[model samples]
Target: MKTNRHSLMAKGIMVLLSLLILIFIITFAWFTPPEERNDAHGVSMKTKAGSDFEYAIGFKTSQTFGEYLVTDFTNSEDSEWDIEDLHVPGKMKDDQITPVSYNLLYDYQPIDITGDGYTLIRPAMDYGNWKINTGSFDYSIAEANTQYISFDLILRSKAATTLSLGPNSYAIGASEVEGTTAKPDGSKLTGADVERKSDYGNFSRDAIVGAVRVAFLGFDDTLTAESYSTGTQDDKLNHTPSLLWVPRPDLYLNNNGNDLSTSGWSLNTGVTSGTTFNLQSQAMNDAAYSTYRHQYYNVFEMTNPNDTVEVATDNSDYVHVSAKDTEGNEYHLNDSVELISLDKPMTVQENNEDVTYYYGKVRVRIWVEGTDSESRRALSKGKFKFSFDLTTNG
Candidate 1:
């Protein structure tokens, strides 16, 4: 009887052990397998050209645009992009951009003044579209999305060459010599003043020179010598002269392709000059240049503030990426990116061969923190109204 009792006890102990092992196996099976994340993303692209003047005189302005692969990202506290290798080698396909139309818009004041100091000013607006042609895209062995491959093209002036001063009217100082007539003092001068005094040389040499000066120097024609301020004409209205950037061929090499290829530009950190990152205000308080302090505005952060830096404003804004968490599915901000899409102004230089070119790159310099995969998908698109303006430094 004692032997029988021992066998039953042994069986009970073995059964308990088996039950515990089975329980462990069942628990492991119930847990979900680690998520299989594939680092794949679908990217879409669009392009636009921005400028105050869509065309020059009667000449239609044009620019070419394309995207390169970026792959090298500095995994530091602050993200940095290394542009040593501009193209991505492993990616079979590259991002392609369709030919974008560059629409030009401008506001200008054309002045006509009478001898009596009465000025008539007419403000005009213009529009034009740029023609884009795709070029060769080379690849580099840099990390994906970190390597940059630049695509560039030439921008030709294709407008019908319309006259700024139409045929109906002659330029203020360029008119042909008409007959001279009455003078400002109502006195008849000797050189054919009997018929028309509007001749190019009809007025005193000073007056003719003054008219030309006024036209180009932006002087107020209505002010007479007595009415004008005493300070050097520049002192009273000391505004830095604005410019229209015209590209020169000499500054850059023009190959047989008639195109210029550059490593292009990536986002440069800090306020280092010549960086293309857009400007943002932390809404902090400061004293100097306060008009632009708190407000958010577009800035080119270029080396030369005197040189004209043009931007396209028809469609520009921050693109926010967001997604929802699986648990609470709480949507959160993933990334903040800004791209400045504008018609690249041709760089015009003196003592250089003038070649018209249109080329620009969109750089992302600022990335707001807290960005993740899910949030990026949620806020796939965001847009703000944009406008292009002119700035000059003396």
Candidate 2:
């Protein structure tokens, strides 16, 4: 009887252990994560799968002055890719100013793959040799990732003076090298093309220079050669006197002591009938006068009337002027003067007075430093325009 009981207990323990093992197997089969699941066969199995492959690129629509000029490209595919080559095609309007020089800033320094930075990537003639070969460095775009390429558009001071006030467009192209793919229409990837425009909407003729008028204060004809030399004479002398004097006849205007005035004096219109002058129409407030008074007078003298002259308070009097956009952002005049000067042009709408104002009007001032005839002839007068095209590839 004892032997029979022992056998029965041992059999029951084996049955219970089998039932636990079965429950564990069932639970694991139902609750296992998808990545860890086995095949239908009771044996463990593994498999690899992926989706349809693709590739693409895109750019930002607009950019403002003083802001970083960023050009970005995106890759939309599972495969890694690289930019084989890039080309930027640009052109200017037939009558617009030609771009002489440009300096581009890169996020990463360009490597000397071929020992010549110019041959690889540099500003050349209008759309001639502006192509860049970027294969040396690891300029890679990971699966479904995006990369940004930026440039700080810099122009020679002389170049910015000639930039036209309108839209300038460039054709930019980028070619894929590593993994050339096809489009939805089944065409292979030759290259991608995009259009970019540097719009100078705020720097228009209507905005910079408005209606203009001129008035010449006549010469004081009362002085003789003898009286001119004598310090006792208080007579107003016209033009530069034969001899040097402290209070000599120079171009002077009534600015309520602002010293802002137009060009030379004349009986009829100031200087000439068609001659235009840019004068500070209003008086400088105490704050502006205290801060920028010296700059105001200095720029007023150096700047030519009617013609677009860049003026800056920081640089030398002869240095090219910087400009502000409609948003009041400052930029080099050579790059583009799409905005007004910080000195501010006067508007008739605000002042409501005639008196042949100069602030907002398209005009320039004239002043003879000495008796030099050539210096007087250096005054420039006319309307100016500039246009150009630019292209980039990466």
**Residue ranges of candidate 2 with Cα displaced over 4 Å:** 1-70, 73-280, 285-394
lDDT over C-alpha atoms for residue 278 of model 1:
25
Q: How does model 1 fare in lDDT?
A: 0.16
How well does model 2 score by local distance difference test?
Answer: 0.16
Candidate no. 1 TM-score = 0.14
lDDT of 1 by residue, 1-394 (tens): 0001100000001000010000000001112211221111111111122211121111011211222222321112222111221223243333543322221111111111111001111111111101100111111121111111111111112121111111111111111122321112112211333322222223211112111100101223233322121111221211211111100000110111211221221111111112221222111112221110011111222233221211112111221112222343222221222111223334434278664433212111111011000011111111101001111111
- Local distance difference test, per candidate? 0.16, 0.16
RMSD of 2: 38.1
Residue 78 lDDT in candidate 2: 24
Cα RMSD, each candidate: 36.6, 38.1
TM-score for each prediction? 0.14, 0.14
Worst 10 residues of 2 by lDDT: 15-24
